[model samples]
Target: MPSQRGSARRRQRGVLLAGIAILLLALVLAAVLASALTRGKKEESLEPLRWQGRGTTRNLREIVLGRCYGYLAERRAELGDKDCLKIWESLKDAFIHKNPCNATTEDYQPLMKLASHPIPCNKSLFWSKTNDLVHLYTKSSRRFLTLEDTFLGYMFDGISWCGDPSAPGINYESCPKWSECEGNPGSVFWKMASKMFAEAACGVVQVMLNGSIETGAFRSSSIFGSVEILNLNPDKVSEVQIWLMHDIGGPQSESCSGYSIKKLKNILEERNFKITCEDNYRPVQLLQCVHNPDHPDCSLCTNSTEAP
Candidate 1:
């Protein structure tokens, strides 16, 4: 009986030892897995930012080349001796293989020079918070030209692009937003373009401001207010005419005599620019009435004695 009891005790000890070995093996496996997961996270964090905004426009090169060729074909007289291939190369070199947020205005100088064309005197139009209406008016009137009408702007008006340090250079997967960084490619390009456009303005220039903007029509931080207005040549640009237009229906929060307009006027006067402000300029209002003919505000010329 004593022998049998001792044998049972020995078996119990063996079973306990086997259980401990299994537990130790499981702990080793868990530690290895945890270490591997940590290493993976560290490597991922070391990779460059992929950016978070809209991806670079699909077929970016094709679109840019197409626009360049189209501009040359349509405006050969204005754009003399421009090499589209050189312009594309300059543009690509501005941001390619670099951090998307590191591109600066100076980097676009070559591209700007390659794509530069003189904006005719008295035809320069600037707009603030009235992008759609301003473009519509320009399209219909064909009297004035905005920055977007030029070759550089025409090529990249709504397109987005950025660069990566990885393969292919250009980040077709994603691009940074203007608000993401001060030196983002898009913001830098537009700033430099706006400055050049304003500097080229000669004789009287027109600015279209949105009267229905609740915060005010003239924002000091806007491209027109900051870059364009500040860069205008006082000697070449004789006058700055403002057309403050409200929406077709109601809520005309601002006007020619409002604080915003007054502020804009003061800025122009300080810069030696002859300023003229008109609320709901008749011509632009007429254009707006084209789409909203049933609106009461569209009855401007209804009582006219003249025949169409």
Candidate 2:
């Protein structure tokens, strides 16, 4: 009778173990289903960054920067407006002479002599992916490349590229193709060009390691078309964007999806970019490339009735 009881207890224990195994399998399946359901809901909540042809594009861009990245457009945001002015004066003086690339020429020494950043590439900017874009996040059906996050990453990398007190640039290789790339002999030049890279002052610092960061001259004369600076630290932040006029076609060919896609792909893979361009030349759908330290002068953000 005792032997029979022992056998019976063993059978009961085996059944209990099997039951627990089945329950655990069911829970795993349920969890997976829940995850799938959550993902479906998120996809339904967001929209991609669309190229809303023309007038709305610039406005939308400005909105993205202002509402997305926390930066200001005013000249006052810059610490040394006077120094920039000094740099510009030096540039103007150098340009007065017929020979331009002779920055080493005594006539152009003033421009070459930079007390701070952009000595190699003055008035430059940086572009990079943000934390959210890199790691990505899901919320509802909406997909947002958060402006603040991405720009912060760019600025962080950019500052490091420029470095403190901003060193002078030593490398400015020819842009190769003489035809469309750098066509108009001496019309273009790199003020600050260096292959040596450093950690970003803004982002994860790992960003600048790729050598895609740059600090060169922007094509803007007026502050209206100038580059905007977005410094990221702990204390402050605000969203930002811009909306500029875009031709459905004609002028600014960089807007072509083919070109943009290629450029983006290059940036992603190699962290390298070559903006061998002239102002307002090729056909364009819209100007899509804009990010932290590498973008232009503007700033703003307002509450949206449309849900974020």
Candidate 3:
């Protein structure tokens, strides 16, 4: 009887150990499943940034055919075919199936050809690193027209787009950032567009440049610097006005007489285009003063400066 009881106790011990082992296995499986679920959630969170072109294409069409047409409705007679499907096609073809970072100006030749229009001479305004302020000034006063006012530029302003060579459409989420790729879709379009705008420049043209930047008001590598300035026809562009714009607050680092500005003036003069420089161009100063009347510079924002 003692031996049998000992045997029964041993059996009980074995069963208990087996149960513990099974429980541990279940716990491990639960942990693995939980880890997988967490990973899936993390991946799902990143979906928006990598959004493929299927949805973006539709939005692009809407921007080209919808919003842009409305903006150009008043001038439709001058810019024929409010229908922008062909223009959209040309733009897409320029980068589709091509490397996202390998698009060049020539790649956009077809699109440029389709979107070309005669900008009124002397009304053209170019800007570098001052897109927001320039647009606000132009939109409100309507004194100067910018590339952003054009149908092609208006549609894609502040937007990023690129194509995937492996995919058939735009890779909105993973498109290269500006300065990441020299021949990026956005860069190529702007290069071609700036060239055309500069070539069309007539009479006195205005360029709004930021003075606070360490790179100087005129950066030689900027689209305005490299493309626009080089393309400005000396015969058509009688004068090139440099609006060296500064902020209303303190920390003024650059001026119209800065080394960079002098280089820009020399370039224009060499091209036979009369150069003019205005420190804190009047209209821009007025806008800054309007924004910050309490600023110290606001009180001194008089148009007091020697002519170029």
Candidate 4:
């Protein structure tokens, strides 16, 4: 009987040892699984921001101001903080009214201008050297002026809107100095002359906004930005648009990122001017200029909303 009891005890001890081994193996497996899960989570958290989706490229200013004011919360602290707040508040106080349709400033000039101004387009590439242009931003109200200024300077139908070097009144179109190329519509000489005028007007605006042209610029130099139009209500107003034609060399980009629509927006904001509506320049380059050689020359292309 004693020998039998000893054998049974030994069998029980072996079973206990087996159970311990199984438990240890399970614990090790559990630890390995936890580590793997942790590593995966870390990798996911550390992934870099890749702009993989098909969206346009945005300028730094346009991205910051456009996103910040429109979608994000109002009042970013990065800009001239409290002082900016006060300035914006005062500016908006004169504009925002008990009545949405008839708000105006203390000077009454803005009100008069809004009243007298001809049917305003939804968006326009305005040409001005006026102070009224730059006062659109109001951090206190978190409002940004809208409108994308695609190109600056005076853009008239016949002339490129730059003052002629030969004479103040004469432009690229009718320079007596260029009697050699009169009635030539748009000769090579005329095109170059127009470019010069556009560049000069753009340069002047740039100087006023920034201390140096290299540090900052207008038109061609203005890149990747946004402008929030102030007091320009689409519902109350008429037409609005921006020019996006490929008159210059090289292939015109279908997307805004490849172009400087945002940059134009930013430069205008710096000048205290703002615009509303998209700068209508999509990828499909259409010859909409009245001067197009093709049939159905649509010269009446001024701010009629973007075509999807």
Q: How does each model score on TM-score? A: 0.83, 0.23, 0.75, 0.25
Please report, as a residue range, the 10-residue window in candidate 3 with the lowest summed lDDT.
48-57
lDDT of 3 by residue, 158-202 (tens): 666677654445665566656676777777788888788778779
Identify the runs in model 3 with alpha carbons over 4 angstroms from their true place: 1-58, 300-308
Tell me the tens digit of each residue's lDDT in model 4 across 40-103.
9876644422221221122322332333343213322322222323322332333222221122
Model 2 ranges with Cα > 4 A deviation: 1-74, 81-85, 98-267, 271-308
Per-residue lDDT tens digits of candidate 2, residues 207-305? 100111121122222111121221222121121111111222223333223333333334333432222322221111112222332333211122444
What tens-digit string does per-residue lDDT give for candidate 1 at 38-146?
A: 9898777545566778877888878999999998898898889988888878888998888899998779998988888899999999999889999998988989999
The local distance difference test score of model 4 is 0.31
Best-to-worst TM-score order: 1, 3, 4, 2
Best by lDDT: 1
Task: State how far residue 198 of model 3 sits from its true place (Å).
Answer: 0.7
Candidate 1 Cα misplacement greater than 4 A, ranges: 1-48, 306-308
List lDDT for all candidates, in order. Answer: 0.89, 0.29, 0.78, 0.31
Q: How do these models rank on lDDT, best leading? A: 1, 3, 4, 2
Note the residue pairs that clash in candidate 3: 49-173, 50-173
Residue 153 CA displacement from its true place in model 3, Å: 1.3
Native-referenced Cα lDDT, model 3: 0.78
